[model samples]
Target: MKKRSMAVMAAFALAAAGCSGGSGGANPSSGGAKPADSAPAKTEAPAKQVTLSYALWDKNQVPAMEEIIKKFKEKQPNIDVKIELTPSGKEYWQKMETAAIGGTLPDVLWMNGPNIVKYASNGMLMAIGDQVKASGLDLKNYPESLVNLYTVGGKLYGIPKDFDTVGMWYNKKMFDEAGVKYPDGNWDWNAVVEAAKKLTNPGKGVWGIAADMNSQEAYYNTIIQAGGGVISDDKKKSGYDSPEAIAGLKFWTDLIHVHKVSPTLAQMTDTTPIKLFESGKVAMLWAGSWNAIEFAKNEFTKDKVDVAALPKQKQQGVVIHGLANVISAKTKNPKEAWTFVSFLGSKEAAEILAKTGTVIPAFNGTQTTWVKSTPQFNLQVYIDMLSYSKPYPVSKDTSKWNNLETEYFKKAWTGELKIEDAAKQVATKMNEFLAQEK
Candidate 1:
């Protein structure tokens, strides 16, 4: 799934308590009248029916999720589930925060790296570590990066659902028409520059690539490749002002300004980079594995496009991020919620998701089918990238600094400010925000 901007919510305190009561059997006939009565026959209580609300943002994955839910229902007949779809981005987080405040959040919902810390730290999500231990669920079945992504403050709050990494998507037809060699794993940043130069054809009104200013799909990968980072290892400071980070930022700026091989920020804003690629206006695009289905379904790109690993800079690097299934802290049906979430994290559910070709299932052995699902493209590149992938940077109040990034980075993308100047500004202000996170 594509990364979305999260909306900040004011923190609110909440407390929950559990109570239990039991009756002592036949409190010894103190009244004397009941001593002669026969002992009552024991009767078993009927199972309680439960309906769980599952909230998610991506409608495209609903079918696969439904299939999993159908299988879950066969095993858990008393627990029915309802799916609630909300458009991703600010709206989804806004609604979630509202639900958190009101204690009306769904029993189960999707969580991502950026907001996991915020929610889990605020006690808005249930910690599933104990449940995982009790169930004897081996987390080694999922990628270590993904398992770590959902863990906050030594507690696991979410179960990994799926993962995605960025790749270089190229239009084969454009490459053939331009007589340019196809990109491969061995290619480096210099190779991309040279190929882009050869691929750009002004007379045809086609740019070599769409170097859009996106984090996960663009600069974040470049930053790590350049041996810089978005945040410090401690997550307490910004690394944007470092020389390596500046070099990473310059990579895209040079693509737009120095070489003129990419569409300007304004041009991309008018027609998104994906649209440009879909319409054959750009020869190449960098996007997540989630775009495979859409590209395969698109008329222009279905047969003509293929994927390759992103070109290396100082070294090979890509940003890895994924979604997780988390339970709401306020959910009344905690037992049922855990049951459903635990099922969702199982190998069976991952296999079902892989078969849909919608995502790379986080479960290790299950991704093979997902790689095979889209045979037209080299979907395995994304899987291979996991070897050198870095986790997407995040902090407790990620949205706060994320907003600052967009604000300052846009100026650099548009050539309104030098890349170094803009990055430095972001680093300064981002550090200030980071200091206030607690």
Candidate 2:
């Protein structure tokens, strides 16, 4: 799931005052004991009904997921899929970790770039490479980066479900009010800074931008554009200490600390940057494609905002990442689970997701449907960005360095440490974590 999805889910819960995902629930029909790992009997006896648990995090996509499930059910009537929702990213992963340790992981579950290496390396996940080959599934149907993402040590553990890219989501009204030209494909970092200065109105309690701690949507893109990587290609070294990486980190801090065109850490914490942008208090927000659902649903932004290609620095760039569906190595119902996971990765499933506008289905050629799903906005900007976008950076253990990023960067964001200092500290600690990863 995209980072923004969790924040959006929290907002949705607050509005509804509420909150499946897997921590393992017993199936009375299948008994609480493990079943033998044998392929379905060749004769297909009785077609006994079997229930498989499917875990995912985004509540906003549940409707589309259910539609896909309906399609799956139509094909396999004897197989029942139980949708388990874990609305919070933190809680979802915690539960998944516990379930993994207990060998009670759900039959099928959502997987992301950050955790793929950890789970797959530990032998907690079942590689679907053989299954894909046997099924004649085209690996070319998905983006090569995403296919490579789920591939660990020559084994494929998951299949791409959906993908996302970052863009500059801006309020046109604010741009017009400030007499600043709207952002476009040609705009660069300097252009944005100049425009932001004109758009900022301190007396009106408005900011030109919201530079928060969202790496996927913000710094990561800039860092790569600046010719720095988060990790070495071998995934054994840190790049945060490099000059290019430091430049990327400084770009954001300068906006808040030096330029004074963005909200401070405290101000942002009071009300999220998303709320500020939606409420017309911030002129622009660096957001991912996952935000389309939330922005379209929110009354304040539905008709007021639009997106453009992210401004370039040294080069035009953005980060692309996607979610995948994987089956547990310990699943009691491997055949049924693989069936569901296979369906999840099918073009039929992609079309269902596309029509709903829930995500950019990873299946090749389906993005056009998603692009047309929201005609009001230039949704094509996201697809257009693919030409120059880089895969989101990750290592065997992305969360280790990712966590340190928030920890050390907070000092710079809060004005307690220089951007260079924070970045150097992050680099030092991140290197330690990278070294520890086998």
Candidate 3:
């Protein structure tokens, strides 16, 4: 498996031809800011005719996302923005490394949370704090934690485009057929466990739930709700071994062993839990809002698949991942690229994303339609997630522990290691990695 950012491998076809710009980065058609209110029309210089290449990973999102680019073009007509999608997670990084090694990266790429910290520290990203301030963006509404995620050593590098949380994806038909009541937003983990038992029918090839050992999908909520965190405050240690965290990890591990309502982690490794849910092999899946588009487009139809808020653990909460639009440090047209990058984080862009149901926008209050638009299930889960959401863990070396999750988590999931033991091992390894960092 290629150990790299997911967005790195999505580089696709070259973008449509954009406005012509002089080889030297100067724009002949560059122009100005429009008059505001009754003030004399400001004769701003013409906007630069710059073409910026944007790299991303999701190919399925291209069609619906064109509208946003079109909107950006309407305002910044002189700026030609191209979208490039990398093919796979591994290849994305390989190709990006080739570019960076050659000093020819695209003007923009969807920066990853972990990558942002790494690149910014290496001076591979341009400071975006000034640009964000000039764009009149309300970063505060986006979530303070997210702002911190994209920031490294006190400087911002990207804008939080959209932040998403996980929820319990349940099969309504399964519930109805089993004569089990549907789970509401207020459902607790115990309630979910009970529902899982009632829904599981191994003889009929249906399991109550699919519990994959995914940090983002499975254990983050449990860890947080248990009042423990995946990493220590200073990023120098793992908190997985904490009393609260051990309790959390045990909850999921117990489901596979004691409860017997979900698949074992090994079973999930062969095929993801989501695939089980999609194939009608499972009754419930803890999924993130990012799945809304894929779930909506699922062949099973929206009726068979509905979403509800994640069940409460020791407390109410979910792990939220924020997708950000960041400019490449290598861009020659910083001004023009900034214009497009800022546009990507705007309210209009958020609306575009929400309307497409591709993602929950980070802009203030732009996700209302997205949540309500899908009528098959109450969309309130997206909103409900906000109150208890926390940013993804950040570090100078995120990969140090990113993969260790499943590696150590499987020990408990497989019954070889108690949750306490697994947590201790994970913490030990994570602390070693942190100690090695400057």
Number of the top-ranking candidate, with TM-score as the measure = 2
TM-score of candidate 3 on Cα atoms, chains taken together: 0.84
| Full-model lDDT, candidate 2 | 0.79
lDDT of 2 by residue, 1-438 (tens): 456444333322311100111101111112211112212212121267899899887888999999999988888888889999997666788778767766788999988877787778767799988888776566667766677778899999998888888889999888888888888789988998999899899999999999986788888888977888777777788888899999888889999989999999999999989999989999999998888988888898989899999988888877777888999999988877777887787778888898888988877777889989888888899988877766666766666677788788998888999888888888888888778767
Off by over 4 Å in 1: 1-46
TM-score of each: 0.87, 0.88, 0.84
Candidate 1 lDDT by residue in tens digits, 1-438: 112222323542211110100011111111222211312212122168989999987767888899999998888888899999886545677777778766688999988777777778877899988888777677766666677778889999988788888899999998998899899888888888888998898888799988898887898888988999989878799999999899988999999999999999999999989999999999989998888877877999989999999988888888778888999998998888888888888878888888878888876677779889889989999988877777778777777777787888899999999999999999999899889877
Best by lDDT: 1
The Cα local distance difference test for each model comes to 0.80, 0.79, 0.70
True-vs-predicted CA distance for residue 83, candidate 1, Å: 1.8
Clashes of each: 0, 4, 17
Off-target runs (Cα >4 Å) in candidate 2 are 1-46
Q: Please tell me which model should have the higher lDDT, number 1 or number 2.
A: 1
Q: Which ten residues in a row have the lowest lDDT in candidate 3?
A: 16-25
